[model samples]
Target: MARTSGDDMSAGATTPAARAEALIRRYFEACNAADRAGLIDCFTPDAVHYFPPGLPSAPWRSAEAIADGWVWCVKTLGSRWTIEKVLAGADGHEAVIEWTHWKTSVNEVLRGDEWYIFNDDITRIIEIRAYYASPVNKADRVNSLHGFDYAGRGYHLDPPTPDLD
Candidate 1:
């Protein structure tokens, strides 16, 4: 069963993990409600949301853009989301969650996992990388987050050379 925003701890007063989880719950509530202001409050001003290839807007850069995109989804697609699980890092700077997005209007659901990078204070999300539960896109040479600077971000670009005797 998926969890709702009101199913868990309050956003204030708790461990880092609880706080992060609460914030995410609140963010999803805002998204389902199509509350633009509320959505914007959950992220840093320069926050970015990365999506897998094939999405019209691959990377939604900036908090405003992210909020706008979600609002659009809710309004157009009757979008609602549920958090299946959340795992916060011990350091509290990072967390990951599994989610299911329901497009009620179209009767479609998308399941995915999102890796979140929180700001130093752990108050707002600075980055989100979404990975969908779908088959690989064979058409794309490199199936990864579109428009993301993987190289600049120091992500592994190529596999290490194998050592064979």
Candidate 2:
């Protein structure tokens, strides 16, 4: 139950930058759909999706593991994760993204960011390091940028895939 949006593309044009943005959009869509295979396809075999310490799962894990982990997170944890923006790096091998997650149960919004490291082929992610701050006070909150109660708690959703289990 996640809703994702991507910036850096909206002109309805197929520029080189737009192609990169497409990858980000598709990754989020795969997560929302809980398509394990599609999610796996976004990463290399040894891909690492890293969360900060003190989270539910490892701060980092293999690509296959992340597939199941994300599904468990979005489905069981009731997080509606969205991609707010995507910025490709000048190096052309890395990027960082801003994400927002609505923690439905806690009724709060979580704001976070993740750094992406692509594989040698530049078609899949090899490493991802995510950072999230504690829930910012709604009193000082800006318009429509609300966050979740458990948002900044560094929750990790890593789990073993069925085949691996």
Candidate 3:
């Protein structure tokens, strides 16, 4: 459904964490409804959504792009998502959620966790890093987000060497 209210927050979503959770629920609702505008409203102008390797598009940058991608998935794949759980950080700037994506048309299900970074006020999501619970690709050396700039984003590229006496 299209977003009718400007405020994404529910009535009891007074705290930052609650607001963040509410926004995530709203985002999923938009996705299920194929509401492009509502999906766009959940993210900042330059928000980015990262995906594990294998998907045609690795990362969806910008709110418009992200919205379009999900809308397409719903249309073409008969996609629907269910939020299994959500844990918002105490500070409300970050959250992690477990979800199940059902590709109804293909009769497939994917379980994954997504790490979310919200804007300072917790009203909009700025970044999403998705990790899937799937078997590693034996041929691929690293099963990380395909197009993400790990080093530039300050992610560790190598495991720390062990200190042995």
**Per-residue CA lDDT of candidate 1, range 1-165, in tens?**
224323656547367777777778788777877889998999999999999887787699998999999989877877777666778776678888877676666656565789999988788999999998664454543444457564584443443222235
Q: Which regions of candidate 2 deviate over 4 angstroms?
A: 1-17, 135-165
Alpha carbon lDDT of residue 73, candidate 1? 89
TM-scores for all predictions: 0.77, 0.69, 0.75
Candidate 3: list runs displaced more than 4 Å. Answer: 1-9, 136-165
Clash count per candidate: 0, 6, 0
Global CA lDDT computed for model 1: 0.74
- What lDDT tens digits, residue by residue, belong to model 2 across residues 59-126? 54777898988788677755566675578765446777777766554555566888887754466777
Worst 10 residues of 3 by lDDT: 155-164
For residue 150, model 1's alpha carbon misses the true position, in angstroms, by: 32
Q: What is the C-alpha lDDT of each candidate?
A: 0.74, 0.64, 0.76
12-99: candidate 3 lDDT, tens digit per residue:
7778788778888889888878899999999999999999887777699999999999999888977777666678877788988866
For candidate 1, the per-residue lDDT at 130 reads: 93
Query: If the candidates were sorted by their lDDT against the true structure, best first, what order would they fall in?
Result: 3, 1, 2
